[model samples]
Target: MTWNCRGVGSKKFERGLRFLIQERNPDVIGLLETRVNFARAGEIFQKLGFKTWVAVPGMGFSGGIWVAWRDEVGCFVEKENAQYVHLRFSGQGQKDWLATIAYVCPRDKEKQHFWDDMAQFAQITQEPWVLLGDLNDIMAENEKKGGAPCNSRRCELFAERVSNCNLLDLGASGNRFTWKGPLIPGYERVYERLDRGLCNPSWRCLFQNAVVKNLTRLSCSDHNPLLLCSNDSGYGFGPRPFRFEAMWLMHSEFDAMLKGCWKGEGGLKNRLMNLQPNLLQWNKEVFQHIQNRKRKLLARIDGIQRKISNFNRPSWALINLEADLQKELEEVLHQEEVLWYQKSRGQWVNDGDRNTKFYHIRTVSRRRRNKIVMLRDVNGDWVEDQVALRQMAKDFYVDLYSEFHEETVQEKSLFDNCTVSFPSLQTEELCSMNREITKEEIKDAIFSIGAFKAPGEDGFPAVFFQRKWHIVGEDVVKYVFHLWQDLEDLKEINNTLLVLIPKVDRPDSLKQMRPLDYVM
Candidate 1:
């Protein structure tokens, strides 16, 4: 849980903190604007049952930050400043993660320095990281209700910092505004979402079912506490679904991997099922390792650039190393861009525009916006639990399509009083539509489709076949030939997934969504 405690030294603040701790029972707690010294901070944390704690002491009761965790959560302070405290945490049998608790200064000049510090930290940190607390700024005008409009310059700087760090806001629940200012007689009161949770993609992947909730204000403090909850147990039972990433096509081994898996015997459907296991194994061995190498290369490049910037007379070897690393980084970045671009499903942006950052932002924005946080059921009751949300969607769709009772239709004789309006198709013309599909026809059909279009349940986009046509072309042609020869074969390959897209800004009912069919 993260909160801007105002001043933890105060008895009222301390009591509120204890109440929050008891109510939420967070494994880790981050406090901003603590307004206390190290000794007092340590004593307070110890009394509150935190086995490990760290603090960036307040200066003359101005600003301070504290991060405390339970004994089971292993972590150590990596860095700290007047504005923030960073910790590197490692749990047994779990991935390591970095957590930063920050309290940005309200002054504009000081906030610039805060952004610079965050950017530098983002460059060096290797683990999945979460940065949260009172940022003292809003990303958009809507984030502030009655306050003066947010400065565009500050919003731009904050957004740039977040983008550079590849961080996505973990979107909040409960109150839209986390902080409120005092009300005046003639002027409107100020309310802004200054407190939030931001994390990198790696952290999101590691905690796929995690959510940050902004709890309602229960104390005198202006800022509400934000809680990060992981609902891992609620995830549906099954093996993780297979997803085809465009980045995989950039790997040298990708074509060979497909060719090797496609040679199995049996009908097309069985062959695809056979290929699934091999592809999954290849992903584990190839894709995962390449991601690790890419991260290391980025870290090394960042370190070398920092050295060059600091030194007027950099070593010749250092310069050459930087150049070599940059060349490699470019290739990896292109592949990464392809991956994000495919996921974005955007048409306005094009390749060679060096707009990977834009694509990344768009992709992240779509995911966050599409995510269902809360839903109002038919009874007008709100459902927040993940499992309940899924069940609600399931029931809605089932009831929508299910036939409770059958309707009787009046039978009419076609020859009773009908007059011919148009001539029927000749036998030859009818047979033409059923003519055999050729290998060339199959190739033309595959190539005609957009390469980057969304993949179906089979997890293979059109690009996969187009790029490796020489290797997989024969098998594809044979499959199409079988379908043309036997109409029954079409049924085997006709399965599709129904993707729901919102038709309104904020859809609250099934009727407000449009379903698109995605055939494999």
Candidate 2:
């Protein structure tokens, strides 16, 4: 946890500290702007049952930073200054990582210095790392609510600092605005999200389940407390859902595998469902470790080039081998990009676009933003138990759909009397609708859907049918003919996975969300 308590000398401040220590029992905590000398800061934390502590002396009574931790997280100060403290810490059986907690000066020039210092740190630090603190600046203008208009130049500087460090914000839950200013006469108190956790890609990948939540600000200060959970809370629902990966299409063996697995004794839907297990097994054997494969291929290519460079009489076979490996590496890289792009759900990416890291960051950030750590029940009570949260969500949708059914039954006749004002289909249009669906029409409809669109329960995306049309087209067209004969055959094709998407940021109630039907 990290907090800028304004001043930590008061009894109230100590009481709050005591409460926090007992409540969360965090492994390590950082106190920013403690406004007390090192001795006083030590005295307070030591008396509060912290097993070990360290501090940077205050600049008069306005600035000081302190870090204290129990044995659970061993903290050794690698570097320290009035502006920030860099620590090498480890806990919970994980490898050591770096944490740089900062208390940035609010002035532009001082913040600029902090940015430069951070950029320098970025260059040297290669371990999994995170930077957290009351940064004293917002990343964007919208991060400030009622404050004097943010300086666009300052905002850009902070964003660039983050980019230069290759750090992505861990994003926060609970309070969006973590700091509030003294009330102005004509306006309410200004608010801004000045405190946050930012981690480099390695750190994010290291602690994929890590989260930084902004707790309510202590009454003694304007800045909210940040609680960092560096490991999984053990609330994960289940194994990840399977989706048809577009990257699999890039594999040379993918088409042959489809041809072998596509033959089965079921119709299109059942055969598609049967193909899931085969695809899963084939993926495990073939494309399971794409990155590792890419690394090895690149290494081989490098070795081959080195041999060619060092030996003027390098064999003709050697050159051809190098060319083959390069082609294979290109294909693997393309597959990896496709995988990232699919996860990113980015519409801007095209076939040749290769901003893989950008897509990865977007994918990770979206997961963090959409994660539901807790919810509020209908009684307005916070529900934190994960299983209970799930049950509550399930019950909510069940009741919602039930109530709608009852209401529709009661008002079913209302629609019966409603007259259509829009243009009605002509006899020719009606005849066209009833005309037998043809093979060409089925193929056109299949291609019309987005290649990577969310699929039905069968898990076969449009791209699967589009690319393997020669192999699967006849069967798909036959299935369409069967469906036209008996519309009830639609049962297998209609299974869907209902997913709830939040309508607002940090939504706590089930009603504050909408559902998407993922046809299975």
Candidate 3:
């Protein structure tokens, strides 16, 4: 979400941001310009129940980047000397993910510094990360509608920077232009896809199903918001056909059935148990045959779709398309229903036709196809209601798990090789400080304490508290207080007591050590 707010203060921009958040309710948003100081922006975001990560370079008349995330997603902003926010999405038992939002000045020689800084950050983390923002450079001649004739040098530099980081641009969907100049009646308005999102190869794969939505401007800012929606891709179409075996139908009874059928005779039991392989193989073949026919039908439909897309005049094409689709749908309805009924004995239901077997096949096939189509549609669209969305979401996760299982198995090697180490310090040093408790232990204790709450049991767990501690600088023991802190709204989790511990490494250190227990 790149916007040239001209010179809007934190207050006005915040009201608008709140309105947008309420409207879209996106998990994350990237904002630009935001002439306000970093601290002021943080307050505005906090007021909206959002954790803000801002990158404001000192005293320069340049734009800045800020990302405001929902309170639930634990995000921390790493404030670097350079003008960019490094945000890490953290959670239990999950590999952490990082995303950086930047605002590059279009007319700065220091622009090179931004890329240099980002490249260094990438080299440092080497984790799955996304770097997205208004790069202030258009890649192609076609990308700029009326902006100053495209600068090949700047574009090349941006490309080189991205290549150096091994980052990729998620292909733009819908209109190519991201920002359009207010048009004068005769001449066409200049437009350019300056706002962009780039990610490492690993993160690219993670967001394989994610989409970059080019939204129409509400005339609030010069640049339109680019909404990125990462959805589950499991229930979607791919190169291979997904399968659910009929044997799974008897999965609940498998143990009992096997025990009863092959309990006594050793050799015979072995032979019977071995039959599982043949049974599964036969079921797979049956499933594949059905899948193949469905694929063929889908291919035929897609062929028509391609023709329709290529047709210069869509209105004329729709005439033939509607008739053809109707015929194809009717044929599909019949074959899916009638043939399925003949094969299965009252096991299936066809929702379209009253016959059980036929109804099951046709309705399921149609529903499945429709679901796939919906998945392929643009992001943030309400293609279906809650039930359909939930099912699709579930399917996507299942597919993701299946596809990534091998990758995850391979990731063990990476994890093993990863320099996952804690900063060296003894337990005695921790015990010496009144804050002997590790930060991880504190977090865990907070989480555990909240676990007893019904909301936590129901999955929306959170804890809110105010912390006061003594800040010691040798002879000076200055006491400062931090208040009304919601664990859900924690960003960065930096600034520790006594300046000794890093907050990120302690995941379960506080599980048994309560903050009150320390006083006790």
Candidate 4:
């Protein structure tokens, strides 16, 4: 829970906070603009049940922030200043995470340093992190009402900083505006969405059920409190979709694995159909343990460093072991970046800059944004149950495609009734258009495609063929020529999987989505 209390010294404000604590009892809570020094803040917090707490004294009754938590919450301040405080919670059975509560200065010049600090935090930490409190700015014009039209430049800057840091906005569920201005005689009072909750992809992945709700504003303050709730009952969307990772090409045994799968199949398509499960198994054994491998390497390196520091002179063998561990860690980090970059689908950015965390966050944001959480049915009623939604999707597509299939069976004499004369291609022109494809042309076409583009339903991207040309080129050539020899059966070679993607942020009806097909 986070609230810009404005001034906690008032009897009404103090009573309100006490009532809120009794009702909600949040794990961690932050109070902003307390208008109290450390000594006075301590006296008030003594009555609260929380055992651990940190406070930034107000600068002569202007601004202050306080963070407090119960013993089991295991919260401690990692970094702090007058503007913000970064807290770390010890995760007993899961990975640890950071929470930063900020009360940004209203002036842009004074807040630039906060943005710089946030960027540094993004680059350095792999932990799931969340930020909450009054930021003193809006993200878009729509987020402000009754204001001298929102400064687009300032809004853009705030939005860019949030995006660069890979922080996904944990959109509030209640009030559209968090803060309201005091009454002005001639001019209308202003309201803006300055206070909110935001978190990195790691955090979203960690707490998939996290939600933010804006509480009702109290009579004592202009800003409303925000409640953040998160749980760990995460479930998968459906059967795991197999995606061929680019890092698989980096493995020395990838060729051998492909050879094993290729030898027992009927054709290129059959072989590819059989290869998906094998690749999945291979990935589980080889690449899925990257994070664990990194941890072990780090532990070993730290042990060696400590050993060397304790000794007057370390042995050559010990030094060599440390060097080897360091190199292995570097390779692991690189492969990790490759993994996240592929998942992120952000090929526009060049690699080799150690952007693993950034990519990780990007992937999370994309998933959250794309997921169909709720939908409106034919009756215009909302449907949110997973099973019902899935059934609806299946029925809708089945009916649509079935009708389309029926319409496509039009007579071959569709143009026979036309009376107007039209230009026709010569026999030689027809031959040129339907000419046999050459092996050289096929090779050039495969090589020309981007290596890491989206994979087909066969779970293999162009990069797989581009890299394994030496082993699979002949089979690929034969498959292409076989389709040319029997043009009627070409649909067997044109394998595609149609997937529905939302065309808008909040797609209620199925019509708001479009079908995207993956080529094989």
Model 2 CA lDDT for position 359: 82
Question: How displaced is residue 136 in candidate 2, in Å?
Answer: 2.1
Clashing pairs in 1: none
At residue 404, what lDDT does model 1 achieve?
Answer: 63
In the range 71-139, model 2's lDDT, one tens digit per residue, is: 656678899888999999766577889998889988777778888888898998889999888998878
Which residues of candidate 2, in runs, are more than 4 Å off? Answer: 72-74, 90-96, 124-126, 146-165, 233-237, 286-288, 298-313, 317-319, 348-354, 404-431
Q: Which should have the higher TM-score, number 2 or number 4? A: 2
Where does candidate 3 have its weakest 10-residue lDDT segment? 466-475
Q: Pick the lDDT winner.
A: 2
Prediction 2 TM-score vs. true: 0.86
lDDT of 2: 0.82
Each model's lDDT comes to 0.78, 0.82, 0.54, 0.81
List model 4 lDDT by residue over 1-520, tens digit each. Answer: 9999998879999898988888767888899998866667667777887767899875566679988887888677899888899998886687789999999888666689888889899999999999999999888887888846679998999999999888889875456689998656666789989899989878887876676767778988999999887662332377867778888787768888888778874778787778888888988886668889899999999999998888897788889999999988888888788888888888655655888867886787666555565577889766656789889988877876784644333433565555788899999998997887899998998898887788777677888899999988888888888877883378775778777886754456887788888784
In order of appearance, the predictions have TM-scores of: 0.64, 0.86, 0.45, 0.65
Full candidate order by TM-score, most accurate first: 2, 4, 1, 3
Evaluated against the true structure, the overall lDDT of model 4 is 0.81
lDDT of 3 by residue, 39-102 (tens): 6767666777776445464337557666676767778876544456778888835577888777
